[model samples]
Target chain A: MSEFIKPTPMPRKYFTPTVIFLSVIALVGIIFVFARLIFGIGTVTNLSNQYPWGIWIGIDVAAGVALAAGGFTTAALGHIMHKEEYHLITRPALLTAMLGYTFVAMSVAIDLGRYYYIWHPLIMWNGTSVLFEVGICVMIYLTVLYIEFLPIVTERFIGRVNLPGLLKKYNNSVDKFLRALDRGLDKTMFIFIIAGVVLSCLHQSSLGTLMVIAGPKMHPLWQTPILPLLFLLSAISVGLPMVIFESVLTSRSFDLKPETPILAGLGRMIAPILFIYLSFKIGDMVIRQTFVYLTEFNTASVMFVIELVLGIIVPLRLFMSPQIQRSPLGLSIASFLVIFGVFLNRLNNFIVAYTPPYQFTPYFPSVGEIFVTAGFIAIEVLLFRAFVMIFPIVSVPQIPAVHKTKFSIRGAK
Target chain B: MANQSRRNFLKTSALIGAGLTGVSSKPAKAAPNNILDENRMGVLVDTTVCIGCRKCEWACKTAHNLSAQSIESYNDRSVFKNMRRPDDKTLTVVNEYAAKGDDQFPVDVKVQCMHCDKPACVSACIVGAFSKEKNGSVIWNGDRCIGCRYCMVACPFQVPAFEYGKAIQPEVRKCDFCFDRTKDGKLPACVEICPMEVLTYGRREELIDLAHQKISLYPDRYVNNVYGEHEVGGTSWLYLAGRDFHELQFPKLGTNPAPGVSEAIQHGIFAYFVPPIALYALFGGVMWLNKNRKQDEHKEANHE
Candidate 1:
């Protein structure tokens, strides 16, 4: 038993590289951000009123919400469906969501024209706008996520071992209180879980609606009234797979036990959702007769076909094979492909496919834009590492030992 | 393009169908086509008499205190390749037209806000940034503009442009039909500035008659149809052209108004406050049921 079940404390050393890399990237991004602010948007980004939104819209809002889709998916199966087998994977999905949203909030700060006046949208009233609804929903959802992560933060910052003199006394009560609070949180999660799912459904779709008003300026291949539905479905399709990919990577890096079977099961469930997405996506195209454009190889036409093939069909086919799902490297690659596909599809919608029919220049995200995007990702990671270290996020049994298991020793989560 | 258009038309109907499906059980009947109220005001532009000189564009810029275009002094020789549309800096532009079968081939169109009676920009705006005044002007207020640039996107003419350069003081700028001029009972800056007595501002009924009169007078030169007469549910500023209107970059669109289709759909779905209210109730009920189910499971486990 001793030979099979040796344990090691969380190492402080492995975190250095991640910290150093993020700091270097963030410093570079901060400089470019100032260039954008001081010299005006025209100086930095290729964005025109013709394409007022560029990479920020695509990467920050569209992809951000889609990445954040894991939380709702996890909540759906784990909490509402009452599946205890998947409980260990919930914290990882929640971590992904928290980071995804924090990045989004940062993106919003950088993207807004009158950055200060963003509060006006919140403070003022406009009942009819889908944007207003989305804004309110996302804000409420963000607040709920922090509350969701509250136990983790408390555990990290207020541990009995970490707490110094007087506060450390009656550590048993503190431990008891934390456990009870954690259980209470689990008990009361139905409302937030449901709200998160629905709000995600609304806002992800509403992001499509944001561009719907661009009458003739947008290319016909991208613009459709069913945009909201397409966006919502695509977000879910991308999100479920993302959770599996992220969970495995984090587990491996942290030297934790594998959550492969549960994650693979989740990946299998996403297959049908992807099918629905593919059906609607293709059905919309075929019905619109955009398939004819596949024969004609213009920039717009090629982009339209490429977006469909890479973002949809390829990822769908890759994930279907049970053989590939078992291979960690294969699963990771497939996950990366799906994520990239979703991100590219959004960039296509927000930038590539968007056009001012009256003939204006195109828009692309600048170097500064890229940095801001990276910084958000970094902040989320930093927060995640902090959360996992302090909280009971990884189930204790899942941590992998450096020595091979004599009797099936579990690995890191 | 023809086959694609037919497919698009089919998709448009499908969209209308999909929109209706999400709403109430009752099937949607077509609203009355005879619902147009023709008492609205308009402007009349005579393309034949108009010289290529851009007096109206200059006057509009000066009146609005907008940035003067360098293309004005340089002309189309160097900058037609770098052609610009109405933007935050330039509120209006006069594209030089040298029509065939003429010595100089000199004709110009002074383009600005069309001041649509049923404006798409107004409907597209979530906040009341753009509004249709009763006195026949589509006015804009900077205070309420979210800088979402929906107005820029919604304008079929590509008229509204954003102040993307100013991070703090950005606002959407366009010709507001020179609402300030109309309020003081004066002609719009463009109309007042026209050197050739080509552009006319008056009640829409009077303008339609004037357009017809010019088209009749120069049956050889002028096209019979008034450009803005039935475009996008009718605009206050009308146009009479020598060649086809679309040749001059005028977008060919439906007379039914763009906003009418989108708003009616949004309103029908959002009307009676059904969607959000129903969604909230359903969520609340599910949460309550879920809480009880978890408790029941807990009790069963304890008993075991």
Candidate 2:
């Protein structure tokens, strides 16, 4: 248990190459998006006033926010509820949340008309606006998330052993310092854990409630007063499944053991929460009778029905089956489906369902926009790999390296 | 030190519990609704008197120093070629709708900003860029606009247009109901420029009465309905489409105040102290449960 992590350090040569690669991708993305700004959406992308918001709005921000809810959800289920089973996976979930949120800032860079002027909202604050609330909460939550995930990075730094001669050349202070920092992380873990849960709850719901101010402009099929409630609930339902999917994929690709015990409990948890979310959403729609809008078979209503079926009913049913939950393939399929559902629900609200009778031209992301979005994902994956490689992301450590590396060395000899 | 503090915390737990109870049960007053102006100035457009000529639009542009959208000339045969709208550049436009009956030519339906009483655009604006003035106009000050285009998303009328091209000067452009004149007790340029006396600008109550009186006097010419009286939380601008408004692309917007739903529900649940207080207790309770359970686990491990 003490030797939870081993020092590998991916040969320092890969560091600069990786950094250079990332910087180049970011630079290209910046240049292309800047060209769009210089020329306009017409020059780069197919966005019009009709389709004012597009993939940049839906996928990058909304879905991204929902996905990042993992930070709070994992903390609440693992630490707060004292679910010892999920304790092993908590660090990775926190890491994902941090990366997901940082990407939100990246997503904002792609979406805003004047990325330079984002400071205006802060320099000249408006407390009344929902965006103001969202902006403030997300900003604060960013710090909270860093507080939550920083320990994982620090822990990895602390737990690393077998330091080579160069690292030890600076004397024993660096080693002692890292050990002290590791102890400090454990002591303050309780505070960061609480802060993570509270802040996440605030911003996850803020994202949904932010849209409530849209009034009639937001198509009736998706519009509701209790938007924050629906948004937060949907985020929680999606967060668990997201962790499940990531866990299984890593296991299969790396040829690790199945995380069945943890994954099964998670699969069972998702269906009920999803069922509740659907019940509330439908009940709210019916109680308010916004369902009346369904008679008019416009784009918004049709998409709403499709989202309800695909994102909710189908995935919910599949997740409930014990056989399905037990099988890795079935669990992966369900997990993927759950993510898709969350993605589609957000798309329906942000893009497909939003109508401005004044002038609506449906916006699809420009090629530059798509690359930027992809760039954010790539960075997230890169960060995950780096952190997991350095630290013990998986609570349950295994002997994969000793088995595989010894075989490779034998083959070489 | 930790043991002493823990003992102290436990001893005062009853007092803290009582204090928390008192702290809750109180209604929270969120920031005031700056968007709601006690008196918002508006124009009640009587659709019946509107003769299909877009003279008011021409006068509006000339007064505001604007450009032509589609109509290059007053009598340009394509005057109604495409249904023109008030967009980023143009503040006023008149759309023509033909009647189902024997009336010749088209009836002019002027389109401008509705300037709602409870303006969603104002609340949606994060920088206080938008303000519903006491004189009944929703004004936009671009000094603080971050240009997230959220105001574009929030407006019920979908009135605010983002100057997307002018990245440097990306402001929300909408009809302010000419607030520049209202502060001086002068009518807006469009209201003053109406040659046929079609648009009347006055207090909302008087305007409603005038619309009703006209409908009563000549029921045949009007639809006997004031369009904006209760539509979407009652806009300051009213309309009188002589025929059924649907014929003129006036959507079947209900009289219910839809914007209020979000504000009301959010305030109802959270504006009071019930949720946060309850949430804190729930979190504390869960934490307490975990602590006890952990102690039991330690005991079991030691015994084993």
Q: RMSDs, each prediction?
A: 8.7, 8.8
Query: How far in Å is the alpha carbon of A159 misplaced in model 2?
Result: 9.2
lDDT of 2 by residue, A1-413 (tens): 12332322222233556556876676676676677677654455555544556777778888998987777888899778877556666666877888888888767755666667766654444544667667766777788787766555555555344467776664466667767776676676676667667766766776787777665567767777678888888999989988888888667544567678678888988899989988988899989898888888877778787788888888899988999988878987988887888888888778776767665345556787676666677677767767665655654443433322111100001
Query: Residue A336 CA error for candidate 2 (Å)?
Result: 0.5
Off by over 4 Å in 1: A1-11, A154-187, A396-413, B1-40, B67-82, B102-104, B260-273, B280-304
Model 2 error, position B107 (Å): 0.9
Model 2 regions lying over 4 Å from their true place: A1-30, A37-45, A120-128, A158-185, A252-255, A281-302, A359-368, A390-413, B1-40, B52-55, B62-79, B272-274
- The DockQ score of candidate 1 comes to 0.19
Q: What is the lDDT of residue B187 in candidate 1?
A: 81
